[model samples]
Target: MADGDKTIEISMDRARLDLDYCYDFIAASYWSAGRTRGEFDRSVEMSFPVGAYCEGRQVGFARVVSDQIAIAYVADVFVDPDYRRMGIAAKMIDALHSHPELKRVKRWLLATADMQPLYRLHGYADLDDMMMMRLDEDARNRDPLR
Candidate 1:
């Protein structure tokens, strides 16, 4: 959803995803830097991917890793710089929640240095008591070939 001429359309189908655009954005992103196209494709294949398109070109993307039962881990949420603040991310999350396989999911998790307010609207609270711990190294120091 956008204000003016730029109307964003959300698609849940992985086949509709713009591989080059999504892979390029993730490859250069701070949180997912050095990720190869093959790895990105595999992730998309295994997860539920959402794409936001503007006039046919992909402008935003997000994905959820879930077992279709207990929990869903939302990840790789990235909106193109030009398409930010227009509710694309929120709409992606909405699509995830309304999805047939995920509508009944009891738990949802995501990690972000910022954007708490956005997730809060969806009832995600700060996990102050038990934080999400990761085993991998920081994305910035990670090797592309590793």
Candidate 2:
């Protein structure tokens, strides 16, 4: 669970997640600036979430939505400003891809406005023209707890 320095610990245990730390960091993030607490909590409840820590204090977080059979979508990968570039994010992603429940997944997907190079280490590539998405303009207005 420790990174190269062995000072960081990464955990997939849902109970170990620090909600207060995660919500505060993600709420102000450019990608999820307006995300509600309920939405964040629901996401954690439904997904295989991972947290990176140092000395028992959380420093990073990521999650993967998967079926435990095949296919996975990686999202919400955030490392604290003071903890970036320490291979924490990579370790979290590796934890997901190599986790016993998801190692067999054939396809993994994620979207990042920047930071492509960081993901490249995990075998993520540029999307092909065939890839597409449809949006729900008011999805945010929808209740996540519902």
Candidate 3:
């Protein structure tokens, strides 16, 4: 096999997740900063996770919150700082797209501030004329754990 082909592997196995690495990365991210461990654990538990591994160590991660039908929301995608520029993120997205359960999803959604270019390459388009709305619930303010 070519060195490029052997460089990384992507898997949908939740057992292979490195929670500490994942949580730490998400906690430091712009979107999920200040996220608690319990929150991370719960989120991961509720989603179908994908991990990209290099030499048996997880180097990237992503998850899909799907109803296994019409919609699937891609969330918490990240490639370790050390692993950026390695095409790992694109591969991870490809794996998610090719996932058996997600294959039939009519719509896939994700929110990204700076990775629009990357996502655009995968057929995600800007919601230029459409209104994207959300209910802003402050979970930290409502959760007793805070």
Q: What's the CA RMSD for each of the models?
A: 10.1, 9.2, 9.9
Cα lDDT tens digits, model 1, 33-82, are: 77888999999999999999999899999999988666789899999999
- Which digits, one per residue and each the tens of the lDDT, describe model 2 over residues 31-133? 8977999999999899999999898799999999977544678889899988887889989988887676665566777888777777776677778532312
Which 10 consecutive residues of model 2 have the lowest summed lDDT?
A: 130-139
Q: Give the alpha carbon lDDT tens digit for every residue of 1-146 in model 3.
A: 11455488889999999999899889989989788999999999998899999888998999989885667788999998877888888988888877876656667778887887788788787664321212213322332321
Models ranked on TM-score: 1, 3, 2
Worst 10 residues of 3 by lDDT: 131-140
Total clashes in model 2, counting residue pairs 3 or more apart in sequence or in different chains: 0
Query: Best lDDT goes to which candidate?
Result: 1
TM-scores of all models?
0.84, 0.82, 0.82
Residue runs of model 2 more than 4 Å from their true location after superposition: 1-6, 128-146
